[model samples]
Target: MNPTIKDVAKLANTSKSTVSRYLNGSPVKKETEEALKKAIKELNYHRNENARRLVRSKTQTIGIVVDSITNIFYPSIFRGIEEVAKEKGFNCVFYSMTSNKYKESYFQNLFFEGHVDGIIMISFSKRDKQELVEIAEAGFPAVVFGDSAGIPNIISVDVDNYYGIAELVRYLHRIGHEKIAYISGPEDAAATKCRLAGYLETIGQLGLKVNPSWIVTTDWSNEGGYHAMNQLLADGDFTAVVASNDETAIGALRAFQERGYHVPTNFSITGFDDITLASWVYPSLTTVKQPFMQMGMKAATELFRRMEHGEEYPSERHLLKPELIIRDSCRKISEPIATLK
Candidate 1:
């Protein structure tokens, strides 16, 4: 027996009208939305899309949900999505959630309500992933523009985080760096886990000893990078730091400069995500370039195909390549670098 809206309403302790408002993309209170989402998940409750689509019809619009608009990486990706949208004669409504879970729920509600024929999402959390999987399982047309490691149901278009980090590590080794440290993003992120695995695997292959203290954990923020670098300074010594992204790398650079360390002379740093700031910063950042625009294009293309072909359409997982952008951040060192015992 399939769950009904009444079951959802009952489990959430909210009125049927409130649940209707939520499903219809009407604004609901934050706590109410949370409760509804929880109830929906627990009960595996999905709205009657077939009946809804009979009334709404095709809108020829696709929704895009990005993690952050201000982050330099997304605009290029947006451009890519836009390009595909134009070619396919579709319109796009871009939404930036900015890490707010409730806001994400609001957008998901819009997606569920048949407002858009399809949707492309970027930077999903574990909770977001589960919800998205459920959404896809319900036969919604969707694409994720980030890691989709554990979930096979949802279509994903992502850069190769592991290969990118491996190339970065190999590049550092080639530049005569033996003692290296890594500043990682949140542990739960698939990108963080994959990049960390690459770093560990490559270093092991090269016979380099890893000091556990050298691997500092932080969020993917400049301030987090700055503080993590300071912690590294207090904890031990290393020749180079592999940052999770260009922002953190730049932040770490500032930290080292504040302590009067000359980049590449006394220390070296590298970053992933070759954002615009990477090249503009002093002693320009050596980083890995993720094909942001291509990822967007691929995601949008996959989404439209699924929308047109329905449930029988084959799912896809596109792993785009990452490029190593060499710059002035690193240097060849003759002396052996120090390490914490």
Candidate 2:
């Protein structure tokens, strides 16, 4: 028969509660813990102590909700979360919303069904924000990424979207590109808004007029980028275009190539988020590097700290800086203009 907690307690000459306290690492005396460890090893006892503790407490599980699992960025983030969760002995359950309102709400309801100890939401819409406020108010631990609208007691992990894009814009300006266009992500996304602000600010600082027609908003998908680029190409002549993300940039690149437009020669293009595909693609896209894996690791670490300490970990708003990676995608406009003239 397998030895139980009681058997270990008996062997240690300690009460069940004392053994339990020691097992839980709850400030037991060193001598007592040593005795218990010896007793447990001698008896080869292994009890479902965690299960018993969970019956009276949380399940030690974390709920991760993301906009889309199909994206490479999300998978990298999930891998980071999984690594930290495993190290901390916590189980992680993931849900993909697929950017659908109904599915997002359904999963929100499921997460609230007491299966998880806390939640880490990758991105939330305005409507989702309202729902999440209610969830946080109800005393459930939750953290959101990319939106720092500041709800009470909710932690946020954000990127330096504005500065990142601003740097990209400056780089493009340095390359002598003045007639630039922007392909933006969904207007509803706070990150997208920040990026737009950066683009506009950079343009203004460089004494350039913002062409309203040059800015287009899309759904943050490859198709959206492709179509937006097509429309932009038809509407105007631009020396360069800044895409919201690598996926979109790559898509737009394919579209441009299909139409016999040589990247960096006919037009310069840049993207945000240096995803794996960005480097693999022809011309090797210039982009703003978001530390996706690090973001996930930070989020998971924060959640676990909250769980273990049983105290709010100073609800941080982490805005990590993004680096600009230069590549062949962007062209030097001055050189081309000089050659042409």
Candidate 3:
């Protein structure tokens, strides 16, 4: 038998009304929030949706959770989800993550409180992933996307991160870049891990020497990439750097220019996620294109289907492939591979 709200209340040492208010979207004290979270995590508790719907009700809206609404990659994806929701006669409510610690309670309020019928969580944190998985397993409707959710027993849509970056690394190899560094996105993100793994694995396969100092982890921000690249310039010498995203690549270019190192001349570069700025940049970024809009459309379409057909649907996992766009950022070296080594 699964844990009940009483267990949550007992373990949290809070009244049932407090837990109810917290779960039903009502604002609660931070101390109460922390207590509830600890108790829930300790007991592996999941609120039953059937019980939730018996008293409360849905508002015919789909809530979307995003890490950053201003991020370039999410606009097209949002369009796709909204377009599908519009066709299906449902409204969309977007929730930009404000505080990391309060997210679970906020989601409980957003979901268990009945403000939205279901939720689509884009770019989940590790804690977020576990909570969402528990929510789904407890019979709530959820669709995970953007990064690795790692809940094969649940519904999710994402790109093939390893394949995407591996292709980029291979392309650099084809163009004769031997010494390459990796600029990672947010350290906690699943995409960053996969891309880093791809770079390490492919370089090893090609017999390239790995420099421990060449790898840098950073937040997925333009400034973060700029500073990381600047540090790399101040320290190591490499032929190229593989940025985890287009924004980082763009910033790295700025850093390269500031130091009088011309792109494709002194330092070649690559990135993932073909944002609009990728093409507008000087030399145009040679990056991997993820199917963001298609991914959003598929996630929303499947989510609506689950709403109508049944929530007991088999977990749907969509791993879309990324396309590598070749451009002028990289140049072929005249020296033999052995000589470069």
Q: Which one is best on lDDT?
A: 1
Residues 93-121, candidate 1, lDDT per residue (tens digit)?
97777755645446655655658877887
Q: Please, what is the TM-score per model?
A: 0.77, 0.73, 0.75
For residues 1-341, could you state the per-residue lDDT of candidate 3 as single tens digits? Answer: 88888999999987665576567654455677899999989999877877575455558899998877666678888999999999988899988775676463356567656688778878734445677556554445677775545666567888888889889988888878888899987867767777888989999998998898898988877898899899888778789899999888889999999887778777789988888888999979999999888889989987876665443456778888999998878877654333222
Tens-digit lDDT track of model 2 for 47-124: 675645533245678889877656556777888888998997888898777754544335544433457777788873
**Candidate 2 backbone collisions, by pair:** none
Question: What lDDT does model 1 reach?
Answer: 0.81
Per the 3 Å backbone cut-off, how many clashing residue pairs does candidate 3 have? Answer: 0
| Ten contiguous residues minimizing lDDT sum, candidate 1 | 124-133
Best by TM-score: 1
Winner by lDDT between candidate 3 and candidate 1 = 1
What would the C-alpha RMSD of candidate 2 be, to one decimal place? 10.8
169: Cα error in model 3, Å = 0.3
lDDT of 2: 0.77
